[model samples]
Structure formats: structure tokens, C-alpha cells
Target: MTCVRPRRAARRTSRSANDSTALQALARAGYVASGVLHLLLGWLAVRLAFGSSGGNADQQGALRELADAPGGALLLWLTAVGFAGLALWQLTEAVAGVPGTDKAKQVGARAKAAAKAVLYGVLAGTAVRVATGSSGGGSEEGLTADLMRAPAGRWLVAVVGLVIVGVGVFHVVKGWRKSFRDDLRATGGGGVGQAVVRLGQVGYMAKGIALGVLGGLFVAAAVTADPEKAGGLDDALRTIREQPFGVVLLVATGLGIAAYGVYSFARARYARL
Candidate 1:
């Protein structure tokens, strides 16, 4: 009994350390890193809208841009650490669930936290790869091509497309309903808060549209048995550029994305960490 007591006490101490203020600060910084990434992507898209296609406007592109900045590698390392911390924090949330919730709500909260952990974990891995002078792997199209070559690959691709679309819809709903406010600690009331809300709404809507278009492309690729048709965010944006008044649309979307980035910064500041 004495041994068991000591062991339990040690575990409690470790848990408390993990939940330390420093770790929370690092997690918040991870949000900032994410915000910066979105800002870069938005800027790249804006440039593309203006017919300046100098680079790819995706995660890799954002990392590459970061690499070119002063102390870029160091920043990447810090970002990696921050994201990893966030992943760990989310994982803990997933395991613990939300307090005072019913079983179903608790399950839902845990699932959402698990999803966030995976997302942050991927970003952390990408940041590490960037820091190590390694190029990120193949395009989304290449992955789709590989999958389409397998048995029932087309069906799998379609399912994936549907999932993406669903995620896009969720983002739209969250933004429109301002459900994200629940995660925030304090949103300054009055003009500032209203402006922040507008940015989030616009940003989320733009992201949803982009994701919806990307999913549609994937579905088209599956239907046609042409993996080439499936692409990522950059491809989706390009497809938008091909539409009537596409330039205007793309510019608006780019601005919306930038607004989302701004909203992310606000999240970093007010998030209920």
C-alpha cells in the first residue's frame, strides 16, 4: 500500500508538470504558428489571383517561405515544439473528456479533441521535416493516383472526398454560428469583437468553399478514373481562377483567407488554453 501510494503521488506530480503554465504558453504559440502559416498561404493565393504565380500556396509553400526568413530554421524548430505540445495537450483532453457532460457529449468532445491532436501532430511533423532540410512528400494528386490503382480505389477516393466535404461544411457551420467563441477566453466586446467575428465568418466561409471545391475535384477524379483531376488547396484555387469572373472571385477568397489568418491571431490571444 505504501509503494502504491508513492507511485500514485509521482504520477500526480508528473501530470501537474505537464499542465504547467510554460507548456500552456507553448501551446498558445503553436496557435500563432498556425496563424502565420495561414497568413502566408493567403498571401500566396492573393498573388496568384493577381496573375503572379511564383510559388505553390500550400503548407509546404508556407514552410519554404519561413525557411527563407531570418532564423527560419530556428523558427521551424520552435514551431515543431509548440505544435507537438499542442498535440499532447489535445491528447490529454481526449483522454479526460469534458467535465460535467453526458456520455454522448463527452464522447463527442473526446473525438473532436482526438481529431485536433492528429491535426496538430501532422503540423508538428511537417515543421520538423522543414527544419531538417527535407522536402515534404508527393502531391495530393499523386496519393490519389496511387490509391486509384488499387482495387476499389475509386470508391475509397470518393469516400475520402465526401469526408473532406463534410469537414468543410462543419467549418462553415461553426463559423456562421460563432460556435468557436466557446473556445475563446475573452473576445473584447464592441467594435473589435464584431470585427473579429466578421473576419471569422468570412474566413470560415471561404475555407469551406475551397474545401468543397477540392472535394468536388476529388469526386470528379474518382468518377472519371482520372487521378489527375484530384488536387489540393492550390489546385482548388486555380480551378476557381478558371471560372467566369474568376480573378475577382479568387481575390475575394484570398482576402477571406487573410481574414481567417487574422482570426487565428485573435484565437491565439483569447483561446481558452
Candidate 2:
């Protein structure tokens, strides 16, 4: 049947994508690119903690930082390609469930892979835009404005906020439980191995806290119908700076993010791919 042939071809393409060595390499590179972005974001957060208002402190800010550096354009292009490959890999995983897993686990794994695919796809698009010298898109406020303009948009925004909050909490739980280790090939060797575990815990917690704040802001925006309340990661950090003992807290958070960056590098090497 016509439908059967198409299905078979789709399966074949999925198999090819799953087994591609070049794609595996690129996915690793995507992790490295992620590391670079997180490190920059952490540094920017620390600077913000110190009352320095030099950078944006989010994904876009990280890209801008890279763009300002020497040979940044080439690096950005490579990073975009890497993230695209990662997105493709995850997409394949989402379409074709992992082999030899129980049904429940397979469902969970596929859903997670689908989420990762979306995340990497967005990053790839952003990187490409930055590399192309395009500007003025992807601002948190801008996104909020657009979202709120739709019918039942306030409710929609609220649901999105809730999902983000849920995701943040999931990250916290995952870090606390050390479940991320399941994704790795090996923890590490000796002290380095132990260090990776610690880094992952701290890093996940830090990012989770930040995401929690960001999600809270979105919920606030929805409730107040004020787009200004919703913001990106840099805005989240800036908000943290306004809290009691925020200076020290923000510094700690920055260090934790940097730790995550380092752990990401280890992941680039040890991830199950």
C-alpha cells in the first residue's frame, strides 16, 4: 500500500539518522556550545550581581557576547550547525523510541527527547539569527507581548508559566536525586568523577532556581496583564539581586551556573550520545 511504503521509508530515514556518526559528533559539539553559552551567562550574572549593567545575561546576551569577540561569526555558524544536528538527533529519538525499554520508560524517554529537540531547535534558530546579523527578536518582553495579544492569551500565558515552573521544579528534583547520571556513559574517574556529580547537582539547582523566578514573573505578567513582568534569564538574575542578601545569593548562583558549564563540558565527552 502507498501508506505502508511511506511508513517504511520514514523508518529507514530514522534508522539512518540514528546511526549517523557525523550527527553524533555534532551533538557533542552542541553540548560544548551550550557550555560556552552557560559560562558567559554565568559571568554576566555575576557582573549583574555586582551592579554592572553591561550585558543582557540570557541566551541572546550570550550570543551577542560571542559576536563581539574575534572570529565569533565562524564560531556562531559552527554552533548553529551543531545545535541543529542535536535537534535532529533528538527528533529521531522522539520519533523512534529507544530500544529495549519498558513501555512507560519508553514514553517518558520519548517525551523528554521531544522536549530536548524543541529546546535545541530554538537555540539553533537563535544562533543562526545572531550569525546573520539579525537583531530585535526573541526578547522576553516581546514574546510576552505577542502571547498576550491572542484570544484567551492571559490564560495561555498562565499555563505556560505553570509549565515553566514545573520544569524548574523537575530540574531541582532531578539534580537532588542525581538522576542525570543515567544519561552519562561514565560519571568520571576518581576525584574528577566525584566533581562531575557535585557540579551537576549544584548546576541543576542553580538553573532551576533561576527558571523558577522566570516562570513566576510570567505568571505575574499573566495575572497583571503587564508584559513587562515577564523576562528572560538576565532579568531573573536581576530580580534575585533585589532580594535580601541578594548580592551573596546571586554570586552563589553565578558560581553554580559556571559549575554547570564545566559539567556540560564533561557531558560533551561522557554523554551516552
Candidate 3:
């Protein structure tokens, strides 16, 4: 019994160490992957803004662009691992809950963490698929079309749209209030820190606006009963192009997204991991 207990203790210690190392590595890599994606998306959006056909300015497009670069497949694999790690980390947070918070707050935080886990997990899977050269066609549009064909699918699509809009509003509020600062270990005082904060503010608002527009498209799809009207980030940006002074708006928004990418790099450095 004594020998068995010691062996179990040693195993537990080793497992804990491995977990810590894995979490730290994943957190850093995940942030970098996210930064790269945002940077690519911003670049594509900017090109589109300038009347250049840079192709889709979304996650899938970002992956495809990365694949075209040297050592792209390897990078995608790394990104996939990083995002998978991030998903696991978020899942851990969801399961363990944040430290030193009230019940309600903890529940909310955990829920958010769970949602993030799903997002990262899906992104990781997509990256893996792209890396493997087995990526298929427009899944989002097809999914929307399928949903619309279901009974009461229009209402379901509308609900999804409303939820997305709500999430966009949340991001806008988070930026406006600078509440995201809470997620950081430190936001130094002075010009550099203040600049970073401003960048975050603009980035968040821009992203929020884009999401809001995307949600509106979904709602429109539901109303028109035309799944073709609904789209993702790329489509959302294109819709923005159809508006007045859209190119200018797109360029500004794209710059904001690029700023967010910079902020993401900063986050990798100072995030409360």
C-alpha cells in the first residue's frame, strides 16, 4: 500500500508539471496564431478597400493565404496545435472557474470561457483541415442554406442573427468601457500603454461593427428567406463596400483590425495567464 501510494504521488506530480508546461506553451502559441490571423484578415480587408481583389478576408481566407507562404503547411499545423491548446485552456477555466469571484460572476466567466473554448476548437479543426489539404467548399453558406430549409428555419436563423448582434454589442461595450484591460496582467502607465489601450478600443469597436453588420446580414437572410444573403466576415466586409463611403469605412475598419493584431501581440506578452 505504501509503495503504491508513493508511485501514485510521483505520477500525479509529473502530470501536474506536464499540464502546466502544456498550458503555458499553448497560451503563448494561441495568441500568436490569433495575431497572425487578424493581421492577414486586416491586410485582405485593406486591399479590398483599395479596390483590389485580395480574396476572402476571413479565417478561411487567412488560412489559405498562410498556406501559400513558405512553410505554410507547417505553420498551419503549429497554429492548429496552438488553438487546440487554447481551447483546452479555456475548457480548464470553464471547469475550474476563475479565482476570487462571486457565484454569479464565476458562472458568467465560466460560460464565456466555455464559449471561447468551442470557438478556438473549431478554428483549430479548420486549420488542421486546411493544413491537410482536405478543406471543402463554403460550409457556412451551406449550413445557412440547410438551416433555412428546415421547419421554422427562418425563425431559427433570425434568433441566431439576434444572438450574434448581441455578441457584437457586447464587444462594443467591452471596448468602450475598456473592460478588456481586466484580462491583462498589467497595462503600464505612460504613452506606450495608453497607445495600446487606444488601439484596443478602436480594434474592438471595429470588430464589433463588422460583427453587427454580419448579424444584420443573417437577419436579412431570414427575412428574405434567401440563405444566399447571409455571409461571414468576408461577406460582411463586402456588404460594407456596398454602402456610402464604404471603401473608406472598410479601410478604417481594416486598420482597426490590424491594430487589434498588434494588441493581440501585446496580449501574448501581458495576458493574465
Candidate 4:
């Protein structure tokens, strides 16, 4: 009884510490960092539309752009800290239950949070690597290639593609239904709030479209027994560039992504801790 009590007390202490003000602040700042990265990627996508891209239209490309900016090194360090904080918060959420939710819903939500924690942790690691002069070599193409060489690699790649497609669809639905509101505090209805909602809807849908296309590429790669077909955001953007009215579609998608970035800044302020 005494040992069990102490262990329970330790868990409570850890949970309490996880909700610290500074950690929440850093987690919120992580949203801003995400916004910056999205904005840069959108800009790169727009540049692609004009046939004058200076870099890849993806997260790593965004990181490279950030590193080249004034005081970028310090900014990258801060972003790394912020992303780590966000990852920690997600991990905490995955471990702890939110009040009032049903058990099944809570389980599903926690699982999703756990997935987000992994993604945020990976982003944090990438930022740290870039800040320390590491190129952080590893592309989706290379990953697909490695998987191809392994047993049941093609099936694994197809599954990954399907998972990405599912995620993209989920994002689109979340934005369309404004389900993200559940994650925020009481944000009153007003011009600004409506604007944020609109921006989010556009942003999520655009991002979904891009991800959907990218995932399709992977699926195609697996079905055709070719690894060269799989690539990242840049490749996806290039694919969009080859379609009819491609310029217009690409520009609109880029603007939507930038809008999403702006919405993320608002989310940082209104999101529930």
C-alpha cells in the first residue's frame, strides 16, 4: 500500500509539472514556428508556380530558408525548444486523460496525440540537427527505396501511402467541419474569429490536396515497382505544375497554405493548453 501510494503521488507530480506555464508558452510558440515553416513552404510553392523556385517546397526546404535568414541560427534554436515543448505536451496528453470525454473517444484522441508527439519530436530533432550544421540527409524517396529492398517492402510502402492519404483526408474533414474548434478555448464569434476559421478551412484543404497527391505518388511507385516515382512536397508541387490550369491551381494552393500559416498564429493565441 505504501509503495503504490508513492508511485501514484509521483505520477500526479509529473502530470502537474507537465502543465507548467513556461512549457505551455513554449508549446504555443511552437505553433508560430510551424506557421513560419508553412509560410516559407507556401512561398516556395508559389515560386514553383512561376517557374523560378530557389528551393524545395517542403519542410526541409523551409528549414534551409529559415537558416539563411538573419539571426536564423538563434531562431532555429528557439524553434527547436518550442517544438520539443510541444512534443512533450502531446506526450503528456497521450498519457493523461482529458476530463469529461468518454473512454472510447479518449482512447482514440490519445492515440492521435501519441502520433502527433512522434511527428513533433521528429521535427524538433530535425531543427536541432539543422541548427548544428547537420544536413539531416534522408528523403521520402530514399526511405521508399530502403523499404523496397526489404521483405514485403512494396506492401509496406503501399500501406504508408494509404496512411498518408487517410491523414490528408482527416485534415480536410476536420477543417471542413470546424472540428478543430474543440481543441481551442472559447473563441467568440467575430470578424477575426470568422477570418481565422476561413483561413483554416482553406489551409487544411490545400494541405490535404498536396498530401493526397504526394500519397498517390507513393501508391503509384509501389504498384509500378518503381521507387523514383516517390518524392516529397516539391515533387508533388511539380506534378501539380504539369496539369491543366496548373499555374492557377498551384498559386491558389500556395495562397491557401500561407493563409493556414496566418491562421496558425491565431491558433497559438486561442488554443487550449
> For each candidate, what is the lDDT?
0.84, 0.88, 0.85, 0.85
- Give the runs in model 4 whose Cα sits over 4 Å from its true position: 1-14
Backbone clashes in model 1, listed as residue pairs: none
Candidate 2 similarity to native, TM-score? 0.94
Our model 4 lands, by Cα RMSD against the true structure, at: 2.1
lDDT by residue (tens digit), candidate 4, 64-128: 88999999999888888878888888887776654447887998887887898898888888898
What TM-score does candidate 1 get on C-alpha atoms?
Answer: 0.89
lDDT tens digits, residue span 185-236, model 2: 9986899899999999999989888999889999999999999999888888
Candidate 1 deviant stretches above 4 angstroms: 1-19, 99-101
TM-scores of the candidates in the order shown: 0.89, 0.94, 0.90, 0.93
Query: Candidate 3 deviates by what RMSD?
Result: 4.6
lDDT of 1 by residue, 122-219 (tens): 98998888889887688898999999999999999999998888888988898889887787887899999988888888888888888888898899
TM-score of 4: 0.93
The candidate scoring highest on lDDT is 2
Rank list by TM-score: 2, 4, 3, 1
